[model samples]
Target: MALKYVEEYRDGTLARDLVKKIHSVSKKKLRLMEVCGTHTTSIFRHGIRSVLPKGITLLSGPGCPVCVTAQKDIDAFVAFARVKNVIVTTFGDLMKVPGSSSSLTKEKACGADVRIVYSVFDAVNIARENKDKEVVFCGVGFETTIPTIAAGILMGIEGKLDNFSIYSANKLTPPALAALMETDGVQIDGFILPGHVSVITGTDAYRGTFEKYDIPSVIAGFEPIDILQAILLLIQQNEAGKPALENAYPRAVSHAGNVKAKQIMNQVFEVCNASWRGIGQIPSSGMELKKEYQRFDAAIKFAMDMPDVPEPKGCACGQILMGLKTPEECVLYKKKCTPMNPVGPCMVSSEGSCAAFYRYS
Candidate 1:
């Protein structure tokens, strides 16, 4: 069979050439961080780390939505499960994230009526079917998934599904990048920016961050070639002492991004301060339902209030997310916290650095 478009990008010869170029140009001890969980997994899956030069180190950032979700938010999801006549719906990754005292899976096992939903619309459909039951969807993701949730809210409004609501833990990318730069011990030479999030936010969304920090950054696709290409670009920039933000995946991304999707998002939601698991609250980094859309706000409807909780002791998820440590450096990594019994959100979520390390490394 002829090679498909995607398969062509994964070609062995092309990848090797990029790797050789990366080794050649990479002379400085560069700490390049792939600021997307998907990129983290992809790098590990393709053994990109193994092929890289000894001086070049790749770090994982606060890119995994589930991994970065605050402890209080997880507690809120569990709290939703405890509400009477409430059907708590969420993405599959959230099922195992350990909240302060309990997880959604534990709540469901204790009969809290938690359901795994693939989309926000699925939760809306459930709410429509069970008119008497309050359906709360745990909305957690980045720009790629937030607009769809907004569209689902619009759908719920059209269908008059008053029982349907969402607890939005949706986050923004650029703000988090700025937060990373400000972090005390966090050291990153460059960033392998998220491709999917960049598709919606466009390259322009990061221009402010890039211009302010002057870090060599590149938006890359999930494929090995794309990542290698991005690494090569970052290396080239660093070697030449020229920092820039470039788009390696221009086929799917542009300078302005998806305007219609952003418009839909802005219409339904507004910016708010959001807490990251390891990283503390970053201002204007979260999305919450606007006043006009508060009817769909699950936290308000259920009167849910969860106090913040500290992460597990010796669980280096926070440090790992900040690119300060790797999974191997964590005390509880494979010894105490396997995926079967995850001590941290990083182990629970598939895109998490720990989970990616466990699976691919």
Candidate 2:
């Protein structure tokens, strides 16, 4: 029964029907951006583009946390790794992301205690085990992961774990969508919003952006059918001249979202201006620990202030994220950048647009 249920969304007959519907209704040259890294990987992995009408173009947005993380934050992580008696914990995707001078992987190879943790809890555990050393978790994620990080901080408080801290590079989704609308030369007809993010933030979270831009927007899952259905909805809205914010993945997302998760996240972190890797700073797009929770802020605890540094000269990750350019348009994409050795974070991260293009395009 479980297998059947999972396969239902992947059924070839259903997918073909949706693809035909998309082709039938898609008249205008629509540019829809999927604002999730998982969606980008899923689109390529399922060959969704191959089946879509040439009139509809899918653009990858700055959805990957690692890909969107600012260069200064990456440098800060590298700085943390270099500190004495410090255990720098992070997700595996960030290991290869090139900082200004060094990366966590390089620091680890040179005897720095940089550990890859599956979750913030694992970093907490490391702090629990090594009470004498400072364990700093590299907090990089969206709404889906922030609550867990907040819970991890609570756990640390209960256990009296003073050595645990997190350098938050966490980003919010809605502000980014607004910023995209304001960006010059970014022509997006509709948005295939992130399902995972919507699950936490709910449909209401996008209400402001939707009302302001009046763009056709649909929250979609990563499955082939889910993506195809979202594309069809956007195309239908575009063709009918009625732009609406619809939730295509109603099974997992709600209008109010997970209230408890948002409450917990708010309890620990507050909204602040945040910088993106390619794009500059977007107001109120970042989450920082609250005043009461300042003790757990790694940046404050360690005085690790990294200066703003320009990205690699030829890297166009910022442009790619903004839909202004594609990975192929970047001069360093395949020539000097690959998964093994990346010139930009877009190539290093698994959900990065360049990595997706390299693997499946």
Best by lDDT: 2
> Per-residue lDDT of 128-233 in model 2, one digit per residue for the tens?
9999999999999999999999999999999999999999999999999999999989899999999999999999999999999999999998899999999999
How far does residue 341 in candidate 2 sit from its true spot (Å)?
1.4
Backbone clashes (count) for model 2: 1
lDDT of 2: 0.95
In model 1, which regions exceed 4 Å deviation? 1-4
- The global C-alpha lDDT for each of the candidates, from Candidate 1 onward, is 0.93, 0.95
- For each candidate, give its TM-score against the true structure: 0.97, 0.98
Q: Which candidate's TM-score is highest?
A: 2
Q: List the residue pairs that clash in candidate 2.
A: 278-318
